[model samples]
Target chain A: MLPFARVTVIGLGLIGSSITRAVRQYMPSVRITGHDADPQVRETAVRLQLCDDVADTPGAAVIDADLVILCVPVGAMGQVAGEIADDLPADAVLSDVGSSKETVLAAVREAAPHALFVPAHPVAGTENSGPEAGFATLFQHRWCIVTAPEGTDPLAAERVCEFWRRLGAMVETMEPAHHDRVLAVTSHLPHLIAYTIVGTASDLEEVTASEVIKYSAGGFRDFTRIAASDPTMWRDVFLSNREAVLDMLQRFTEDLTSLQRAIRWGKGDELFDLFTRTRAVRRSIIDQGQDDARPDFGRAHD
Target chain B: MLPFARVTVIGLGLIGSSITRAVRQYMPSVRITGHDADPQVRETAVRLQLCDDVADTPGAAVIDADLVILCVPVGAMGQVAGEIADDLPADAVLSDVGSSKETVLAAVREAAPHALFVPAHPVAGTENSGPEAGFATLFQHRWCIVTAPEGTDPLAAERVCEFWRRLGAMVETMEPAHHDRVLAVTSHLPHLIAYTIVGTASDLEEVTASEVIKYSAGGFRDFTRIAASDPTMWRDVFLSNREAVLDMLQRFTEDLTSLQRAIRWGKGDELFDLFTRTRAVRRSIIDQGQDDARPDFGRAHD
Candidate 1:
């Protein structure tokens, strides 16, 4: 049996559109409705036929749905929840795919106190964004962290987990605050560092930008892919998850400082030891099937 | 006409083995001799038939060659140059594929001063190492920066560029010091940051190592690939290119500090603007054919 028979997906961006597509591919009998704040995106969703019905308003999208997933940026989650609060079906399970959980959970509770909310974050995405950039298999083999706080209905949380499982994600339950911290290290800090390094490389006067782009295969390009991620979403993520992100950033800065000192003092042993240990992490990531096993991410050499 | 009819490569690691394979594919008639300090690597090179001849010693490898390229770590360039000094051909164009040109240039000048030394760095490689991990197209469409000092023979420099071109790389010429600075920003700093962050993530007490690896697709895995790079080579690179790498690191740190402050102060606009600008750099890297254009480095979704 399908966990969600009629699902409404708000904010037809990458994650939102991917959910609509995945539902259609995996649970064809379930009705999919999509709504986006941007008229252009709404029009594109209709043009691309991403959903069974493209709703003109958030309220209309969730009025008859058994599940409502807010796929907007973290900063806008509360507002979107408020938009559909009045019209949402009484039995509908509210959820969100925001990167940060604690803030989103709090915002959502304040906006729709009566809704059965279950917050989740699918740990999958490409650098690309928008409706067209998403696909049905985007979440395949990826983790989906479900943060259903204390007192949340068990059935509602189980249904949320089942929905993600049907969409090809491995569901893991994490405490809201703990989820925020885990994502801070795994996602937020990486994007922040990538953005900073790419900016630094581009701003260098000694090295031409053309030269930077040309020799990027040396390592810089790996960062650019993530540095290229959607600006608004990342901006909201850093702001909403500020405390955990800042804490992780502080730790990263200390580590980086130690490395800088090692380089200055020509302490090759310290550098070598850390480099060797880090290699084992990559091995685990690949061995766990979290990444491509082939060299260079299996990027074609031809 | 070929750049050199007989080529000798010392250190049959990733870059060295790739050079032999590339030579056989692109310039089959050119004689190729290989040598490695490690007996196991030499055995692997011979077993894989990476070169026309697997010489027993560095001196024997270059004794009759028209061109000799050192593919060992930057820290070992001086020692390897001294090893081949007595047997190097008088008219041989000596060169190296070292990441840092300035140090290798000085080392070659000190040990094999009589030989024509042209320093070239092929800005390409995978995280994997050793002979079997290499391929003929590792340098295809990559940039090979040839840093030939002013006193070096013009013909020798051009030949080095041509040799890289034959191996399917686009060659550019830069001053040794400038090349060091450019690569310091583009390559060395990226690797150092990757190593540091991976170490930080793994050492975190709140998040399990397994959790970090499982959720790495969120962004951290992009780093692990480069962090998995050969430790000894990277250790040598940071030490040999100390000033440039440290200078770049300082700039990166300042930028990161500013971003960190923005995140703490909830400066979403500043974060959004920088993130947007960095996206263009990724576009340029893809436009220039320096990186794969496919989303997620063309990682298979299936």
Candidate 2:
């Protein structure tokens, strides 16, 4: 059982629902109450049996709860935190599953001044979203980055780290700024590139546009998966983590321009050199126990 | 049976081997012979029983062949066509599986003027590119875009169309320019972006680079698979399809700039608007029977 014996989970989206399932899977005896702004999601949580008690209100959910995890969108985090601030236990450790940490921690400080806020971003998810998308193994071997602001109690970060550890993830602690920068390269830029390419394909004439989607598996298909992730949630992530994402985007654009110049100038050697070197990283990724070497066609997802 | 009774497949790589396999599976009595530039691939063709008569040379393969299929690299098409131009029977139909049509068609025409040449691009492949990598089901349900010049014989184009149709592909005739434009959006640009991102991740310091790979399931992993495709082939593709790729890259840059601007300004509504719109195309792709929904967690391709 976790040190925090009683926990309140706000929102029953993919992250929230997964946490509810993980808690039940690993610590069944501990009580978990869930709060969602939408009643349909709340009712669905009850139906899925993800939570022991699906509180009709966030206030009811966190009443007397020892810990609270806000699983709302990054943009909505401040508002949700504010709504439950008075209800949160004075000594409770409050955290979030938001992708961006600085903004989340900022909001937590304002909404729940009495509680110990240790901001976290679980670097785990798929293009799929919503409550139904939750899975027990979603975070298996994935990263859970915790960005504790200055003056945050050490015990509070430890308690929050322990929460993610119990849920089957490796935890890392860094300043919120560093976490945002690292993940901007790791996740945000990839999604942005994918969205743009898909949009570019969409802008083609009706005949070829439909055909592009039809024959997307040639290479364009994988981009669509990342491009399909929840919009409002990602919108908030970019809006909140703007600086880092834009910086990385600039680097990517410049690099891509250089490549375009090489291709346009018939520099086959330059193009081949980059293409060859890139393959080594792929081999390294496979050696690191990520990615499989199987043919993409017969693979189920392709 | 194909409209042409005897088929000669020159350059037995993945596409050629797959074509040989698919033909043998569906048309058992059809006469099929294979020839590859490399002796190793030719030997593998014999060991795998991929063809009934493995020809000793390109000339031997095309001799009396009713249909001649060039499966070599796009740059090698002219030489292969020249090597066997005299061997091709007058009524024989010649075709190629090159990624670029205008270049291949022009090259093949220069080599063999009288023989019917229908240029094609099979929109199916894996990162692995060798005789051993070929499988019978590779072309099943994949698109095969054929670009025959305006003056090319209709009977010749239809014969090539019938051949691929027997292999379970939906074949379409397109202008070489249009084929380049559409594929520039669908295949080339996506590959260039993936290669760039994987290369960037590889340039990181040892520790974070290792973690970037380890937890690549977040997004970076997919790029790695594409980055692993044969170096020489992709290099040649970019060099040959330069202009169209550059044009598409320009549009993509503009779109990325808009997105970068939105992120810089913390425009939540704009981010939400674009990201939300991108997801619908993925849905349409799935509905079109192009992409599958279940995210492909990297496959094991040896």
Candidate 3:
């Protein structure tokens, strides 16, 4: 049986569009309604025919939706939830694909008291954004964490989990605060570090911009890909998950300083041991099928 | 015409094995000889037929070769150079594929003062190491910076450049010190940061290693690929290029601190601006063909 009969997705970006496409592919009878604050994106969605209906307002889109997912930046969650509150079906399962769960859950709860809120974060995305950049298979083999707050209806949460499963995701449940902490280390800190390093490389007076780009294949190019991810989304993530992100950053900085001292003091043994240990972590990731096993992520040579 | 009739690679690791394979593919008539300090690696090279002859000793490897490239760690360059010095052909042009040029050049000069030295660094590799991890097209369209010291034979430097070109690499000439500085930002510092962050994530008490590995797709996996690179080679790179790597690390840390502050203060505009600027660098890298243009380094979704 289909988990959701009528789905409404607010903020038609990569994740929003992918949900619509996956629902079409996996649950053909279900209806999809998408809405975006940006008229340009809404127009693009309409032109792309991403949904059964591209509603002009968030409230209009969720008026009859069995499942309403907010796909906007975490900072906008409250406003978007408030916008859809009056028209949102009382029985609808409210969910979101936000990076930080605690803040998003609070924002949604404050804005729509009657809604059955279940927050989720799909641990999958490329550096690209926008409706046009998504595909139906993006969630396949990827983990989707469902952080339904206390008192959330079990049926509503199960429906959300089932909805993701049908769309090709492996679902796991976690506390909202735990989700924020875990993601803060795995996702938030890495993005912050990538952005910092790329900015540092770009502003170097000795190394020209052209030189950095030309020789980036060495290792810098990998960071650039991560750093190129949507700015507004990342800005909101860092702001919304401030405490956890800050804690991770502090730990990362201390670790970086130790490595710096090792290099400065010519401690080859220390560097080698850490590097060897890290290699095992990578092997485990590959063994668990969490990452591409092929060398250079199977990048084409030609 | 071929750049060198007889080529000897004095290390059977990824870079050395790739050179032999590239030579066989691009310059078939060039006789290839190889050697490695580790007996197991030499046996593996022989088993893989990575070279026409797997010499038991470095001296034997370069006995009659017209060109000998040292593909050992930067810290081991002098020892390897000294090992080959006794039997190195008088007309042989000595070069190396080490990450840091200045240190390798100085070490090679100190150990083999009579040899015609031309230091070169091929800015290309996968995280995997050893003979089996290499391929004939590993150097295709990659940059190989040649840093030949002054008062050296220009003909020998040109021959080194021509040899890399034959191996399908684009060659550029730069001063030894400048090459080290450019690569410190482009390669060495990035690897150090990756190694540091992976270590930081691994040692976290709140976040388990499995959790980090499971959710690594967020951004951390990208760092792992770089962190998984050969330990000895990277150790030598950091130690040998200490000054420049330290300088770059200092700059990266300062930038990271600023970003941390912005996040703490909720300075969205500052974070947004830097993230937006870094996005352009990724585009330029793609346009210049320095990296794969596809999203997520073109990682396979399935």
State the number of backbone clashes in model 2: 7
Query: Which is better, 1 or 2, measured by DockQ?
Result: 1
Candidate 3 chain A worst ten-residue window by lDDT: A106-115
By DockQ rank, best first, the candidates go 1, 3, 2
Candidate 1 C-alpha lDDT tens digits along A1-302: 99989999998988999999999999999999999989999999999999999989999999999999999999999999999999998999999999999999999999999999999999999999999998999999999999999999999999999999999999999999999999999999999999999999999997999989999999999999999999999999999999999999999999999999999998999999999999999999998889999999999887
lDDT of 3 by residue, A260-297 (tens): 89888988999999999999988988998888999999
Report clash pairs, candidate 2. Answer: A292-B299, A292-B300, A293-B300, A293-B301, A294-B299, A294-B300, A294-B301
Candidates sorted on lDDT, descending: 1, 3, 2
Residue A251 C-alpha lDDT in model 3:
92
Error of 1 at A161 (Å): 0.4
- Encode model 2's per-residue lDDT on A1-43: one tens digit a residue: 4767888999888889988888888777779999899989988
Q: Which run of 10 residues does model 2 chain A get worst, by summed lDDT?
A: A293-302
User: Which CAPRI level is candidate 2?
Assistant: medium
